[model samples]
Target: MMYKNSILLGTIGGYRDRFHQFQKDRSLEERLEIAKTIPRTHGVEPVYPQDLGADGSGAAAVKASGLAVSAVNVNIKTEPKFRDGSFTSTDAGLRAETVQYIKTAMDLAADLGTDMITVCPLIDGWDYAFQADHQKQWGWTIEAFAAATAHRSDVKVSIEYKAYESRNHIVMPTMAKTLHLCDRVGAPNLGVTMDVGHALIAGECPAAELAIAHDAGRLFYVHFNDNDRGADWDMLPASVHLWQTLETLHYMRRIGYDGWVAYDVFTRTGDNVEAIASTFEIMEDLEKILDKLGQDTIESIIASGMPQQGYRDLVKGLL
Candidate 1:
């Protein structure tokens, strides 16, 4: 089967912490070479500033790693809190700092030939009170980001959402809310970074969510991983919702989503490259399944209201 758009398949840099034990202290350049060696890899490598540090030096290190800075995940709080309305004057100040940091990262990403950055609102811990604080600062963060990204058309912003893991545990954390935040901020470059693991945790089908985002035209980036009803984030793909993973990819193909498929997994051991590659291979196999299933049959199954069974049969037939 011939794929049309160039899908940017890459792993997050944090994988180094998992794969190489003694190489943990390796410079960003060395780590990046390992990351860049992966097949069909592209896009800017993701840097978690809180884990790595936020100075300009971090950005320089990302560039030196031979990987473009695809995006960065900035931690909003050092510790998790259960209360809301925690947006102290200090909190606002920290928000400002985050905006400035994003601007710097965008500049560096541009220099390194990447154009996307992800900003997470808050860490896990805040309850409804935290949601309230998020609602309050949401507007400010968007406005600040819009202004920061106004001059840089190539750089886009994605809001990463999670349920219960890192605060803001709403019964249903919808992309609609995320898109609402972007609309309120009124930034053309802002979009949603849909993480399939979170969607499953929220008890929503990842494929349906992708369809919704595609219909609304708000999807910008994607995080590929799997989770079972009892599992937490970063679980292996095949172990959790194997069919849904394939269905999600089929839906992405139908919607023509040509963004990066970022592996955002965190394991206890940290050598997730094998797992990451396995996940990619699963996705690739799913692609071939879709090729054999054909668009008409796939669409018919999606339209037939038997998505789960139909998708499973489709995969079974392919195998």
Candidate 2:
């Protein structure tokens, strides 16, 4: 049950927000080539429409690049019409289009020889109180997922929940709520993509979040990145929450998450390639450290349930 380490190809290109552009842009071919040169990451994920359009050129480029397709990241946020909301949009037509687009994304994932797709409903939330009808939007979200899951049973559709970003409060802000969405939708293919940074910003321990999703048997994919408690900065792994990331890695192995452990890191001044490659190196180092500590010792510490400072002493070894 080894995890497949991967990188979201978008992180290596020019990163821009409303305020500034992080780096110069690179073509899809260039991004793919750069990814192939990095160590420990044998898989690369590309975005839908933006990177891999319906024209099949992007898919062909990925196949030609020789790196495995970890998962196809469907773009549900960048489009203009989806600015206000996507699945939870007040416009019925926009909601329906989003569901159809998800189905199309699943099709593309299958075409690219993968069975998983990660989606983040980034633009689907509210900015202020009473801005959205909670009940109706929740129902629409359920309906959209139901339709997409019904369209295909072979492909796994995973939702990436962010605490907040473009909107003040996102509709699916937590993994528990997201699993409820899966419950309401009742789709076997539907699951959760536990982004560590998102979980941290939501005030939840990444290890605890992993335990919950894994217990529910809805853990489909994973995104790895560290962040300060207040913001999802997408910093290199273990940069801030070293302890939590270590605990999460233990839980990830315990749950047997044999999917691509992709990254969502963004660098404004540093070299994006170096940042991503070093991120993977850190993860590998953490896993090796765990080996040094021994899983039996850590599990015994957890089972002890002792505020007896059981595994707390292990941090000294890491330092």
Highest TM-score scorer: 2
Question: Model 2, residue 127: what's the lDDT?
Answer: 88
Instruction: Name model 1 segments beyond 4 Å from true.
Output: 1-26, 48-53, 78-90, 128-151, 168-172, 307-316
In TM-score terms, candidate 1 sits at 0.78
How many pairs of residues collide in each model? Answer: 14, 0
What does candidate 2's lDDT look like per residue over 1-319, in tens digits?
A: 2899888989999998789998889999999989988988779889987899855468889888888888889888888888888899888999998888888888888988899888999888888888889999888999999999999899999999998987889989999999999988888899999999999999998899889988888999889998887888889988998888889999988877777889999998879999998888888899998887788888887888845577575755565
Instruction: Give candidates' CA RMSD values in order.
Output: 4.8, 1.4
The reply for model 2, stretches above 4 Å from the true place, is 309-312
lDDT of 2: 0.88
List model 1 lDDT by residue over 36-139, tens digit each.
65565564444545434565466666666555445665444443331232222136655556566667767655665666777555442345654345444555
Angstrom error at residue 290, model 1: 1.8
lDDT of candidate 1? 0.60
